[model samples]
Target: MQTDSKTIYTPFVRAKDSVWEVMSDVLLALIPCAVISYFAYGEAPLFVMFVAVISAMVGEFIFAGIFLKKWNTLLDGSAIVTAILLAFTLAPFTPWYVVAFGSAMAVIFGKILWGGLGRNMFNPALVGREFMTVFFPLVMTSRTIWYNKDYVNFQDLNIFNFLGNGGFTEYMNSIFFKPSGAIGEYSVLLLVLGGLYLLLRRRISWHIPFGLLVTFFILLQIFAFKDIKFSLGGILLGTLFMATDMPSSASTKMGKLYYGAMIGLVAMLCLLNDVKYEYMSYSILLVNGFVIPINWVFKPKVWGENINLKERVGAGVLLTIGIVATTYALVYLHHFDLVRYLIFAYILIVIGRFSFSKQLH
Candidate 1:
């Protein structure tokens, strides 16, 4: 009966748990990643997480109390999850002010303005991260800011030194010990464990994660096979955590598959060319806007209910527009020749429309 995220039109079974309990499970899962981050990068990661969590809580308190007059909403723990997820995406040495600003934007604009929690259109944490990108591009995307004096000094203490030195060995060392990217993206092993925990807890479904990874992996093999290791950690992080967010993703079972696949496709397309910054977040936020149409297009039929042709066609049209827009945006972002993909996407849409019209009759 979770109407806010899942569709109310269908009777789907869900786990019966309070918001705080669910958020607590997510927090517990993230602990290992946080510990690994702290060990790999020193106190910088902790500082970012602390500032982000505090900023999110304070923002939730003020916004929920003043605007919604719902002071008790702060106890939900969704804000904490949003803050932590945002922190995971940032570099260890990201400025505290930037962290605070992103967290504030997440709670105030992304959550509270959308009526809090499940009512938001996009994932609140990703919204915050996107806001940071727009406002503090240098800090968010620059490799210079990713490493600090602590990290450089800590290199001498490499636990993987026992693996011995060489090209392949060093690569192995980086993957197992500390990969060079975001703070939480350091430990692929820990991230996988966290993802498995979420799966065990029923905090997430396999549909989104499986669909996303499989689609992305297959596409990477075909187009950009060499960059797989470089992108896998970040992709895993986004796939396991952000892309599976219930409120912002598709509601129906089949809808979830299509949603995940399209997210992977768009993300891979964006990454095809050389680019700075991760485009997975952009792909997620873009697909978040299409959830409504996806839900509508894939809604299950009720036994005794009458079919509404007008509504179905309307949803189809909206879905077509959404697909076209998403394709255009990805092409534009990478400065790819727009005509090629746009035309292909349009042709597919046309074929779908024709088939759909025939079925309706």
Candidate 2:
């Protein structure tokens, strides 16, 4: 009952783009954000990024020597991409050692241990960022770390006050010019442009990011319209750069859409519960576990492959049960209660199905 793992690497059937080219393009796209961070925060952010990149390269080199026993794959640029991304998720003043540790963890545990690059199930950068957040919450979330005496706070602009109401100004600031945040998420404008560059280069598809943004926008409008301006930068950064990671994300067209929507739903639920700093990263990681199953469920029909009517019926039944549980939980219980209920129901159905198959055998 296992799905074909090889088919889940990416959706590109015949693209001539190499991994190095794509990674190079990504790094190019990130240059403007990096420059903005450097200008705003002085040399601290640059040092952090430099340390992370070195740490990642070293980790990959050592792992390649030991496990892979081949050096050529190290030139693919994925390690550097992972390193830059991990650094982007950190505060500008993050300690050098901490940045190095997180970068190493990202390369060694998240990527290498999972068989590297296209075989990994989760985003390596987010894996590193999550580790840092868990182990160094004080360092990661320190308000003082976000401040730079050398630069003016963009949120305190007089023109912004005259632009619109307080809420509108705040929303615009969050989307366009947040003075304080992770190094790479300073401006949603730059991120959107970068995402567009990737799209134009044919390095990534629009489905995953589009699905995630649209779904999250709908959810906010429905349940928490007032807090719409709260985390626009984080949402945009994650949806554009991290969640769209090809190897760790969904492959099939429909599966990619559902996968992204699921991430959005889980993220909104996390936000509703006040899990702000880790919501987007945690949501992506959570959905990574389901990508294989999602691909299986939405697999394209092959010409000669047999279709299991009984299995299809069982899946339909599970879908029906999930819908009913969602409605009941959303109406009568906490917002997160729907997730818990669905998990419980899914576990029961899986166990029951396994037992039934055994009995038949």
Best by TM-score: 1
Predicted candidate 2 versus true structure: per-residue lDDT over 232-295, tens digit per residue: 6678778888998887898877777877887887777767766657778867877776777677
lDDT of 1 by residue, 196-269 (tens): 99899988888888878888878887975355434567888899889988778887777788789878877876
Off by over 4 Å in 2: 1-14, 150-176, 225-229, 304-361
Q: Judged by lDDT against the true structure, how good is candidate 2? A: 0.74
Error of 1 at 177 (Å): 2.5
Candidate 1 off by > 4 Å: 1-15, 152-174, 224-229, 305-321, 330-361
User: Backbone clashes in each candidate structure, one number apiece?
Assistant: 0, 0
TM per model? 0.80, 0.78
What are the lDDT scores of the predictions, listed in order?
0.76, 0.74
Q: After superposition, how far is residue 326 of candidate 2 from its true place, in Å?
A: 14
